[model samples]
Target: MSGQAARNVLWIMCDQLRWDYLSCYGHPRLRTPNIDRLAAEGVRFDNAFVQGPVCGPSRMSYYTGRYVTSHGAVWNFVPMSVGEMTLGDYLRPLGVRVAVAGKTHIEADRTGMQRLGIDPASAAGVLAAEGGFEPYDRDDGIWPPGFSDESHRYTQYLRKQGYGGANPWHDHANSALGASGEILSGWNMRYAGLPARVDEADAETPYMTRRAIEFIEQSGEQPWVLHLSYIKPHWPYVAPAPYHAMYSIDDVLAAKRVPRELENAHPVLQGFRQAEVSRNFSCDHVRETVVPTYMGLIKQVDDQLGVLFDYLRRSGRDQDTMVIFCSDHGDYLGDHYLGEKELFHDCVTKVPLIIRLPGAGARRGAVESRLVEAIDLVPTILDAMGADIPDHILEGRSLLPLLRGAQPAGWRPAVFSENNYAFRDFVREPLGRPADGCHTIMVRDHEWKYVHFEGLRPQLFNLRADPEEFDDLGADPAHAPIRERYQTMLFDWLRNRKIHPTVSHAAMTEWTRKEESAGIHIGRW
Candidate 1:
């Protein structure tokens, strides 16, 4: 193994990309050669899971090296507390500049910032507002007709490209041209089979790839971390011509579901099952039409990644840069009779994680089965760059040691995920639960997956026996001991979570030592 330090980190994140969609992870049809190349040259983690299933909370966990519970940004559009320290805040002090090229899904803590006397337009305030990243170009990638904002860089770029409309994103980029030249908006799932009007080069994936390349070319010799986040393979599932027609219904895999799952579903699960997205996806025609388009979007992203990887090797950046490929969370794609994520199923909670360490390492091409979480990435990046991971603030363990061919002592036995569904209509209307009582926690170990919902019946699955999670033993009296064991584990995990971010373990130790030396222990006397 080479002793050379990593000079830069290329953190590539894809939105709503399932772990099983890529060929590297054994997708039978959707071949992702570039990502497969990464897996072949690096370590592939088979048991990685997100701390949250939604974009905002999951990404917050990734950026801050903390759980969703710790950050308190439990759902989308929910602002994290202003005092939360992120990867950029930790890395910048160590001379590693952090920048983002695409969507972060981070909403600013405006009130918190204002109360702290920070002007929103100021540089310090901007960094705080963007979840501690220097935004090269930030776009969340969903722009419907009435919801379109012309101020968005992508929208402006589309307008410049002769996509004349009030909302170019919805008109051209996300829409298709019919036989009579009428516009077919991608907002409707029925139109998902049509090719987008925009060219492949001008699409969102390629646009973000170009931005990433520009940032890399402009970063002259400075050690940096560039988060090239791609908002693709998400909703409004439309791809450009070549990619759009790449796959057909035959290429789409069978949806993993069963009639048994619907027989006696848990109350919270029933609430999610009642969602429009879930209901629509449950139809055979919907899955048959939409899934192929979803595959096309994923194929487009893989092609763009091929372009990006080629640029890295050509520029000689591959020699000294660590390239990490991962997603925030997986999309259900009609799995488990669900469409979008926001559940504890493996299809939604588990995600793809491949880390290509710079130079050489002993563990190349290895497959790690240990339970890892999204929060571990920041610590891993900090570890690679020789920076201190603040123990009080960052709770996740670094994966650098594992990359170096050794396992860390006391590795966690299970991974945890959480969700706050109070914002959804199903929770409020159908479930009749209070907003504050809509919280749910999932604990998944080697054999059993346990979910504890607030004021609702628990859900349990024996992964060893029922790997597909079709059987629910939550109400079975025979599984009482297993549920109790996992419940205790969850309680212990919550009790040990780091709450005081301002106080470090080292600082507390030093304070105790000083007090002992000064003979200031009032209780001892």
Candidate 2:
């Protein structure tokens, strides 16, 4: 095996961050200098999309390097099958220690473990959780009562720091202190204006940063992949003291929507707009009050990233480490009359993807607009590490060639994203169709985007003409050819390809031979 100079990988993912929110990505008011610096010194992918728009399945794709359908974890809380392989399962055997310092959103395959007679509380089970990443510090980012005990470590750390409460994650990290010293929980969006109860340093983003730095500092003698995931700019928009007040209402961007977008909406989307998360952004007052805090949260993440980058340089590991910055998915943030991501809009699917290699000075500050998917990260990292790419198991192609400033011939012409909102109970809409009918697929190329819902009308936008996606031409007969072309593409994209190919080629060959040698084929003959 050839030893790669970029042995260490720092995979950082920010939750619910929009692609355009960063200064490098053309956010006019929000100045993300640290993240922008990554763009300045690395390869920035202008059009990187996630396989799934929601947290769980999106992250499953990132961790497993497979699509939601292939992994069998199509929605939040759905367990990835134990038979499936993960990044750790592939990398750890090659002497690379894969560890996560933050959320993976990976649900453990408890049924598989139980059937296999593996103790769920054992070290093996914990490692088996989310593709077998050794938890340097795993926080799933949900801290409500009974939501998860894995996050109790963070709560305990907060208690040690004098953040007292039954659930310190809610009280200190998520809540604000009113003038009367009462807890103003972040659940109330109106309270987003108030500063968080905890100090800025003790907030979730900084805390996760510190934990990641500690992991890097102590990961002695082993070439490792450290996933530093941040749950900022996701929700509970209140930031701590200084960050909370960093931006004012005036800094908030106008909602990216037109009044006419409501015309001819799909049933799935009609239900999405009425969902609690989506409805919150519909109020103009909520948009104005909460957006600044959202910006502050992003700024806080950027500042912490600065700390992380500085630490790498000071530790003298900057030259041998690969730093990748992206998000699981983007936030709608009131775009298209929606708030949270579940739709196929650019604001929800297109994420900021910046990759900084250790010695990629030749292509430094270069930008690649070729269509890329979040699933591509795994193969790319493995290739960068000089490990064998598992061609049969992984569906994404490596971006190493693109990173080296070489354009491969015959790259994918379009990108795709999917969502299964119908299975989710949070969306309590009576769409008259079964849960499977709520599935939606999006196929987008350079100029047009086509969204197909199983039971509702399709949506097509001439992206070149309507960048904001204000006009839906699915109903226009003039665009029939365009719609048909994209429909064929989508159909061909999801055609009868293997979703489960667990057995190796040699094993399959042996099994087929054995079956043939036996009298199994005699009756058929």
Candidate 3:
């Protein structure tokens, strides 16, 4: 096994997480017993998705597998520049090592020397700025030097899971964890005043699974790859203590979304879908106050991913290890009325695709509906260690043939998701403003879903007769030729790909006033 490559390539990843709240995507209640035991030991992909439904263009489509408008990295710190190419610049020139821990946002913030779009070998020569977007109005050097950016970093990892204050990352949301960071154990929370946590053997999702089992017990021979990354179910949804009473937020369900999905749909889910249901996103007020706070942060990230896969199956190394758990996008808690999620819907572009290729060639517990994408996870993690996959910037196509169970040998007809919200005022620069930005181009494939809207109005769902897309067959009259054959398959998928910096016609009309630029403006999608 060591000769075939993967001496180590863990790769976890989460943040804003949501792929139907786990329990192996059935959700019914969202317990996520260590991602349902790594989807019962690996290979779970029921139509995975995420290439920018938010969060730095889906981490620049898994470090450049392309599409986010031909990878200009379109918005959110716009980095990933300087001669793009990374899977950590292709596995640190092959000897591999790599590393990467939690939330590595693609690009933003650059000090003089001009050349911004990042990727000057994705830094580590000591570069800072890791999450919790600062305040007192962020942006002069984006978030560091923080005096206050008005909470968030799960409101300082949930007031450091209420373990007394002393700086639960600078306290304040009514400041009071009296003790001092370190109690928060697991499973507790019915609600009311709610404050008793600190125990899941001292949180921070098992302190980054004890630094990924001490980086695989200090990788002493080399050939590693790590990439941990796990911000957790996302949001102030605290956890620790029986995964904050493991799922009981009024029984949890919600997330369906079809009800006419707001007429003239898909201009990025038109006005963020919401026609009938309200009451601040019902379902018993997001299951008793926002899904018992996102299943108490996804049951403390399924008990630190079962303490790093039970310390890689009790150090036997579970067949030279090759686990993967995804999610860089997804979070639409109240669904339609919405909470967070740049809205592409599927509760924010699907997500949650497990993979664990160890012995007996993966798929042990099974479940793979296909359609995967997060830029096909760095070419199915360089073809699960057989490595060697390179054709330069591959736009994604190596799921190791659907983890070798065979399918998708030539798959993908509709596996794309885009975003460029007026590039979030250079991603929150001076707090940003210009608005009106919209540019979604979904394609769904099987079971009819066409969502095409550069400016607005163009949707045609039938996810098996409205799986909550309610019904906006664009302007039905008998679904006018299934909306012109998915608008010529979204215009031959943008005329056979290729875009970066190409948005021009007087700069797309000084920022989409479109009809071909009428004003001297300069902003919007």
Candidate 4:
């Protein structure tokens, strides 16, 4: 051990990597020894969930320690409103420098920046716009012709490497070359079998890993929080050499589904399955080609994790740095006949949460099965850095007690997740329901999972008996009591989401006592 307290944080998040794909998570074929090592040494949370199922909103929840509703950026490409306190806002006050590299999926709050008279192009404004993380290198990973509509450092690097096409991101990292020398872009799911036109090291995963290592090595005289976000395992499912051919179709696990999920499916599920994007993975041909490539991209990530962990240890930072590994959300990958992450299912909601605190052999290798959410990470990071948690700003509780092998009383009975599918174009006119009526809320406990769509029949699964979620018991007469219980739970959960406080209760009480001094009588009003 470095004999110092945990003064630094290495927050690593991978895009769209599912929890079950790791061998430590019980996958038989996928061997992620590097991530497994982190699990072996750190505390692993078995039931952590993301607040949203997609990229931008999920990342917003993670960075702000708040729910999607509280953050108000409920979908992709939407900027989180400025003045919504972020980890940077919380940590920087205590002298912790939070530096970020790789993707944040953040769209700058142009309106707020303008209103506040902050220059959007300035470094300070950029950091504030991106959840307050100082950029070691800010690469949103979506370049030219993608969601971001901009060029990134990775694209520039590709140009320097003589892959000088007009769209290097597509040609080098996201596309494959045809025998006729045509470019088969990986964006098309059918072309996933093709390998990217780059070497393993030049790939997005390795490039980001190298940049994170550089940031750590360049740190000077300050405790820092480095958000090392990786954009692989979430994509145009092609991987570079070695990783592309690392896994075969035989290694792909059989998609978990029962014929009954399609029979009398909830309107929400039916709508998702019929969407243009979801239809691609409905058949065997696409799944057979795409799933293997997805697995390979994950393998590449695992290999890079091995690299980063080794570097941390070699630099003696491993003993003093708190290492956290998680994902924004999981990909469905044909689960429930759905390809992308939408609708409420364990396939899309549940993600891996592993944390290795500083110092060796301190509650190492313990697993906590309690319900935790992605929103809890910011508070936990703040706690680990010895900073006071600003409870009024963050909606999550810290995991420090659990990390020390102590379970606090009054722990939550269930975890909650939500999706606002109402605004999506596919569901705009199909269901004839109000836009708000297309939203869904998920409440999951140890034994049961309930999903309630705004204006449709709810779906329920007794996870104790059917862990794979094959059958829906929402409409069963015998399960009415169970359904009602969870329904009430969801209602209360929404009705009682923590109200952001302008002043603490004690402060309010103290001020009320001096109301007469200020010429305002409390009760008379």
Q: Pick the candidate with the highest TM-score.
A: 1
* Poorest stretch of ten by lDDT in candidate 2: 143-152
Q: Tally clashes: model 1.
A: 0
Model 2, 304-360: lDDT tens digits are 999999999999878888899999998887888898887898998899999988884
The superposed Cα distance between candidate 2 and the true structure at residue 88, in angstroms, equals 0.3
* Model 1 lDDT on a 0 to 1 scale: 0.89
Judged by lDDT against the true structure, how good is candidate 3?
Answer: 0.61
Which ten-residue region of model 1 has the weakest summed lDDT? Answer: 1-10
For residue 431, model 2's alpha carbon misses the true position, in angstroms, by 1.5
| TM-score result, candidate 4 | 0.95
After TM-score superposition, the amount by which residue 4's alpha carbon in candidate 3 deviates from its true location, in angstroms, is 18
- Candidate 1, pairs of clashing residues: none
Query: Going through the candidates in order, what is the number of backbone clashes in each?
Result: 0, 0, 38, 0
Evaluated at residue 354, the lDDT of candidate 4 is 94
**lDDT digits (tens) for residues 1-525 of candidate 1:** 123358899999999999999998999999899999999888999999999999999999999999988999999999999999999999887777799988899999999999999999999999999999998788887556677776688888888888887677888888898899889988788888888999989999999999899999999888889999988888888888888888888998899999989998887777787889899999988988898888899888888889999999999999989999999999888888888999999998999999999775546788999999999999998888888878888889989988888857899999999999899976566878889998999999889999999887789999999999999899999999999999999999999889999988888879978888898886873
User: By lDDT, is 2 or 4 better?
Assistant: 2
TM-score of each: 0.97, 0.94, 0.33, 0.95
- Model 1 residue runs over 4 Å out of place are 1-4, 515-525
Question: Predictions ranked by lDDT, top down?
Answer: 1, 2, 4, 3
Q: List the candidate 2 regions with Cα displacement exceeding 4 Å.
A: 3-5, 145-151, 360-362, 424-429, 496-500, 504-525
